[model samples]
Target: MEFGTTSRTSGKPGPRRERSPGGSDYAVLSRQVQEAGLLRRRPVRGVVLLVVTAAMLAGSWWLFVAVGDSWWQLAVALPMAFAFTQCGFRGHEAGHRQTFHSKRLNNAAGLVFGNLFVGLGFGWWMNKHNRHHAHPNQVGRDPDIESGALVFDGDDAPGRTGAGAFVTRHQAGLFFPMLLLEGWNLHVASVRALRSRHTGAPAPAAVEALLLLVHAAAYFGALALVLSPLKALVFVLVQQGLFGLYLGASFAPNHKGMEMLSRDERLDFLRSQVLTSRNVRGGPATDFLLGGLNHQIEHHLFPSMPTSALPRAKPLVRAHCGDLGLPYTETGLIDSYRQALGHLHAAGAPLRAGG
Candidate 1:
């Protein structure tokens, strides 16, 4: 698969990852990032983001109502779906505590953006995402890499039979198509998590449940009111399908093709973040579309950094990685997808070959 300019650490292994005596190398880089003021919180950006999202939601709803029971409501669903994913991105930032200084405020923002806006559980996503960040690409520890519907690790690719084998063998071809259902899957997972007594929801289960119910009511109730049953059904399919596809596509490029660390693979914090994640090269449009996730390496290293600040932090992080002789992967958007899909195809090769 094609990639942009990468260091010695890209296709080839770089220096061995041994912790330096006295302290971790991450400390040195962390100090530089912090001193550059990249760690500072900027609430104005958060406020502006919230306002714009709210306006988009409001405008879309108005258009839905204005259309007044027509096939065109499906058109309205397009922007609405995009708006929902934007809300999801904001909730993700809140979960990382990147939007606010106070933990309570961040949690509150997460609830509003997640359960209230996107109908996803903030707590459930936070729990899942935090694990991913802590152990990105780790086969067992990172939930993102754990095999289920799709087998990510080669170790889990063999011995499949029947449907599982067929799916595993064709997973690369099916990946993007499968993402069309991811929106529904996320909703189901959230509801299931909220129902369990041991749900890791940060808010009271009652509160989370209530907000989800409200969102569902408002969302479907409005759709039902404005469109015929068939039209509403079509609209829901279009909106949710596009939502899932958009969200999945935005996230898939970050680390899918990168190295998957085994439990025994030891890496310092800096290396772990840089080595596993990838960056996407583009202009401001890329930043907006990915919600600043295109800068995956910088975001993973300094998750608390504001999204707007990721561009500013990129050069510093890249320079430091260069100094440390670490791999810093950056690719065009299309090429990133190619790398990820190529990895999936390669992982599934054994199944295709009669294993």
Candidate 2:
């Protein structure tokens, strides 16, 4: 481990747990939590995500609007902010599909939110995310967990010769811009994938292209017609930049590095959920900014469960972990963010050709 990082084995005094809910105990664990009578109900979570999304939209609009004619820059900025949240919210449920009982309804909602904010939609994401979850530490196949794929290797094999060595060391910082302009990155990736004839390019790539153009036109043209150019651009910057940064950061923290255990090591969903992730407890700010993504372990275990209920539900996870002797790691927000940055920085360590 790097400086300021400690292994679960070395930390504390008691025996720590690593495994999650097993087959036979699954029912017992659920029964324990359910019997507590504190389990968060479903639709309540859906309603809450929607409510927060609405409040963000409303607050941004009302605040800038209150400023009157002097501040058109904000006009474009605020709605895009909301749009970003809407995108995240959609994916949140799609990942778990716990928000709605109907898979079709969840997928439809995910597609609308994702495309509106330039995401890959539920179907496309599932392909990537599912593989990632299944083989999280595999160097090439795990698209979900970013296990140093962009980072360079110090000790290279004969095949990774020449410039590939230098490229690895510099990838971390270089990747920041891509994270910032992820919407563009997503489009570009889609283009390349389509051109290379990758499976599931959403049929004929041209439709995707046209879809992109139409989305751009609708957002820009509407802003131009209704608001001014200045506000429209600011809106894009705020929502596009901050929203991307936050969402991407949330992802980065979840699985940057805990253990490079193989998919086989992850014998079950619960084990994968706990070993592959950690969380932050940022108090009230967590609810506002992250939608309580601070509870990633709990979220992964009960993916179908809604976000609003995560904080409340996390205790159950902690209790279960305690019983199982799991090393439930919890760091403050700043520390957690620092850990993610360190992961990126470490991944970019430079190396020479092995061959």
Clashes of each: 0, 9
Where model 1 places Cα greater than 4 Å from the true spot, the runs are 1-15, 197-200
Worst 10 residues of 1 by lDDT: 1-10
Model 1, position 234, has a per-residue lDDT of 94
Top lDDT prediction, candidate number = 1
lDDT, candidate 1, 144-203, per-residue tens: 878888888866888677898888999999999999999999999989987664554579
Tell me how far the alpha carbon of residue 175 in candidate 1 is from the true structure, in angstroms, after superposition: 0.8
123-191: candidate 2 lDDT, tens digit per residue: 455556767656655445576544333542222222333564444555556555556676555545544
lDDT of each: 0.86, 0.56
What are the candidates' C-alpha RMSDs?
3.5, 5.7
Query: Which stretch of 10 consecutive residues in model 2 shows the poorest summed lDDT?
Result: 8-17
Q: TM-score for each prediction?
A: 0.94, 0.73
